[model samples]
Target: MTDTPSKYLLNVDYGVGGVTTHFRSRPLGDDLHSETMVLNLGPAHPATHGTVRIVVELSGETILDADVEVGYLHRGFEKMCETVDYNQVMPYADRLNYVSPIINNVGWCLTVESLLGIE
Candidate 1:
């Protein structure tokens, strides 16, 4: 008569000294689950001030991980920039970072001037 090992036991015959060890077939329970909470900050949250959506995983209100989704603001700027002259690209750049138009304007001007060897 032979004894059948439980499914969780690993049957290993080392030839000289055979041994069987029980192992967990499932992942260990997460201790983080008790310490953390998941939060969705914004698709339409007022503090975000825009259409940006962020999934934040927090450990007691401190952000542990964040996933940001920005597709709603996509204007195909890269595709548009590919079709335009250097001078024409500034306005689109202005639209992209509306809060700081002068910086975008100056940077675009400097870039165009550099390309033409004017500065």
Candidate 2:
């Protein structure tokens, strides 16, 4: 019934008494809206975003949100392990990370050990 710059966009009501709103978008100064930019980082190994990606939304120097998208980084690791005995699976789990062989292997062992409810 009343138009207040952002009158209805408030909890009072949608345009009932609050102002308009965008799910995103910030104020640049006093009267201008901040521009939003999306930066995609990671999953850069083969140029495919289907594995894992970090999406960052930036407004000036402020970060609105940073999301980690895991599409298929370890899609079939479990399935791959399913076909082999636990002893043979260390190598497959090793495939998870080559940069830190010991840590990755230890993590895999810990994960499997925990799953089996053992120490």
Question: Which 10-residue span in candidate 2 carries the lowest summed lDDT?
Answer: 14-23
Query: Candidate 2 clashing pairs?
Result: 6-18, 6-19, 6-20, 7-17, 7-18, 7-19, 8-15, 8-16, 8-18, 9-18
Candidate 2 lDDT tens digits, 16-112: 4366422355465763553777776776646653466777788888998887767636548888888998878888767666566688788878877
Summarize candidate 1's per-residue lDDT along 1-119 as a digit string, tens digits: 56764443354642433554222133447653576766777677878755788877778869988888886577798899999887789888887765677887788888888889995
List the global CA lDDT of all models.
0.72, 0.69
Tell me, by lDDT, which candidate is best. Answer: 1
Over 4 Å off, model 2 = 1-34, 45-51, 109-119
Taking all chains together, each candidate's TM-score versus the true structure is 0.56, 0.51
Pairs in clash, predicted candidate 1: none
